[model samples]
Target: MDDKDRELMDRYVYQVVRRLPKDQRDDVSMELKELIGDMAEEKGSVREALVALGDPAEFAKKYAGESRYLIGPLYIDTYWKVLKIALMCVLIAVFSITLAQGIIERYEPGLFTDLGSIIGFFTHIFSTTLSSTISSALGVFATVTIVFMVMEHYKVDLDEGKNVVWTIDDLSKKEPGSKANVTGMSAEWTPDRLTPVPGKKAMLPRGDSIADIVFSVIFGAILIFTPYILGVVWFIEDDEIGKGVMTIPIFNLDKWNLILPVFLISLLAGLTDAILRVIIGRYNLKVMVSSIVSGFIQIVCWIIALKVLPIWNPNFGNELRRFIDSEFGAMDFATYFDPVRFSNIILVLAIFGLAVEMIVTVVRTLRYGLDEGKAR
Candidate 1:
């Protein structure tokens, strides 16, 4: 009837309904509100109505019915949540180790000189890593599932002794959110414990993050192990024959070694960004900050790779000139292509691309995190 009474009634209804499954929450909430209102009218006060209903937790358990599985409904939510996190970590660790082993075993000096060799190299590594990861993944899933099942059977609480049994007083006070207070698994369930449903823009695609991880590993490997594989292929005109194909290495190995650290730092930053995206599964201020930092580091690496370090082969021009002169008389290779100018152009393009990515990340963060009020 009064504002305070109305507030108490709403809080009581929320406590009961929030314990139900997502599909049942809305229907049960409407039913609970109507029931509470009728009871309150008869009882002369909302407090009296709530007391007659008994503890919201126990009332919800009755509605939830009995469990038919090893893990009851009470522990099912937490079991799945913990299981997913554990499996993800296991997969990441397995995949990383397998990939590293394959790469190290296959990699050798001047191993990937051509496109075919490069493709084969990566294909081998990918196939080997996939094969190794599958068995490990199965084992991890089984182990995690068994652990959770045992916990459920034993009536184990993740909170241990921290959370006491729910009481009527809990309905009157809001508790701060804590991971230890998982719904159904602990006695700290409150309306505030419910997470906001993520908007479309807030969600990060797992596929994209996975692709980023694979690409970053491969690209970083290329930078460290096979920089010379990236090259310019040209044709020299020949009088006797039609033409001869020549391949010239793009990056100078000597100079590349010097700037390798900078390139690796950039790769590390990018990998961190991808890992965070996969773990969080949503775009927020933290993910936005990571993206910005990753972009900045990559831009710096590109500048160093293309400008500060003499990574490009200085002898490329003369080498092309010698090959052309042997057949077509005399030619100035600089007139056709200047590696320095090309490097500058690439640096500019790389910076532009990174800038665009950072802007998009910031915009998504604002739209999903700020506008939707779901920053977490």
Candidate 2:
């Protein structure tokens, strides 16, 4: 095959094998490449050869087995993986907040003497736990299912397929150190992969990178859109604040007027990066570019948090004062939650964490890209 045909074949193989199961990827890719090459040789055109194979997406389904399922075989693993993560996040956030509130507000060790009190106490506990756990789990299921459904519908590549391809050297029997020398289904099988040497465009996803993409998109969505849903659940009402539970939504959208626009732009950029990473299943130039944009946005958020964004609610200021006084008699604890100082401290932490992460990610990804970019 000429350089053009070889390049076309490489792209075609990538499209096919990336959607297949990892264990079957190498074998399928080699077989597909061989089939395509033979067709191209006979058809006298690489384009015609690919056309004969049909749409790469449809061709992938042939190897994938055309099962009539909502989520195909290719994405079941990812679906479960994402579902578990989302569920955990939701549960942890919901339960932690509610449980903390419940424990603090209703920490009565004395046995309930009256049947009415006993019934009421148990009912409250059951209601609180049931509401928090079930609601949060449902929300998570919806988010995870929606994301997976979109992926399945679009047939987004999620690294289920192997990242190997056939090379001309496979024709040579005794090529020392050649990747084709690797064995499959044998004692000599070294992962049974003939990994295509990394090139300018060859950026395979690392486990960490893919995970980062998944959680970032998931949590970012939750953070931006459903801020009200995730917060400190407060049931203990201060006499000053009046009767009823008060939720201190630290990331509340109602108060996130200015910060919302800027923060969401950053969030959206991160979400885009994550989705693109799933599609490419790698850290490439585009991914790196997105990271750079996201990093800058994170920095801006930190700055805003420090300068303008109130970490604590203004509405809660007077209530907090009364609550503190009631909980601990005659103790002035206003400075403990000085919004400016607290937010700045939080910003400091955020900036440091994001800076370190960005630096490490950029360096690792850039080195990989540079290594791939070397003249072959």
Candidate 3:
């Protein structure tokens, strides 16, 4: 063979064998090279032989099976369907809000008058859109995964009794000239009805999956990011503790250093779910376990923030009083809005929510490890 043919054959072999596991690579590479050489002899050219073998990636897939698993066999298909829908909804909602806010916030006296300003304006819009999309997608992924994890754990009958028992009599009826078509529409056996024997694949409807994913992402994002945003607002204009450029928002918690990391851990957990959803596309045993860890982290953080640590900034009270006297606001308004009382109410609600989530998650791990429910 010419040097060029040898080089081309080597490249093709490398591409295919590189995707195999390390243990299998050497054996597969030798086998593929010998097979390709034989095919090239028949095909008359190395290029033609490689083309007949088809795409390197596809050939690798045929040999390799699933190279990477985000969701396991039981959970991936549903995860994928749900994720696509959630992503679509998130994209629409995020871009709409981001575009509107970007235009409103970045408008300036000379923004449209110069080339530089126009470039900056578009850049701002693009950055905001991208960030919002990523944030929303992550939020959606976490929500879908957690919900599916719970459902998987419980072995919720996704498609209850989708398959019916078959009989030898039915098979015998399909023999030549037996014609056992039973739909009444068929000219064979005029059975009143027909039931399809469902396959093992989960029967989750795409629309339902999509809706579930969209809702989960939106709600989860709100819960995770609200505190982060508040913390950011608290530190935006002031480097000092307990001080901000604007009047301290009544909703902000004090001691950012203490609360921030806890919040980040929880957020990262949600992000883990998002990445898994994108990778695996289903709720399974592994996803459920990961979620259990994420949930526990959030519950601990919430418990501390609610029952032990102070959630509202004490500085907000001071700021409110100052604002009241400076503006037409009532002086007594600040006194009426008690941060302690406000925090207690929030604590009660948060704990209750966490308790519900914990129960469902724990129950799921106990029940379904990795069983493929009739409905994925």
Candidate 1: segments with Cα more than 4 A from true spot:
1-189, 233-247, 323-335, 371-376
Tens-digit lDDT track of model 2 for 185-241: 333535323433555444444455556655655555556555554544545545575
- Give the TM-scores of the predictions, in the order they appear: 0.48, 0.47, 0.45
In the range 1-376, model 3's lDDT, one tens digit per residue, is 7999999989998999898779988899899889989999999988999999999989988896653444455555555655665568677657666675566556654457889889998999999988988897788889878765654555443323121111111222232122223211445443322322223232213354345444444444444444333321211223364332232444454465576566566555555544443333333343456556766776677667756755667676666566666555666844566766776787678667756754654565445423332223
Check candidate 3 and list the clashing pairs: 70-280, 71-280, 79-281, 79-282, 80-281, 140-217, 253-311
The window of 10 residues in a row where model 2 has the poorest summed lDDT is 163-172
Worst 10 residues of 3 by lDDT: 161-170
TM-score, candidate number 2? 0.47
- Scored by TM-score, the top model is 1
lDDT, candidate 3, residue 234?
Answer: 17
Task: List ranges where model 3 is wrong by over 4 Å.
Answer: 1-76, 85-127, 130-247, 251-254, 261-303, 333-335, 349-376
| 112: Cα error in model 2, Å | 7.2
User: lDDT score of model 1?
Assistant: 0.69
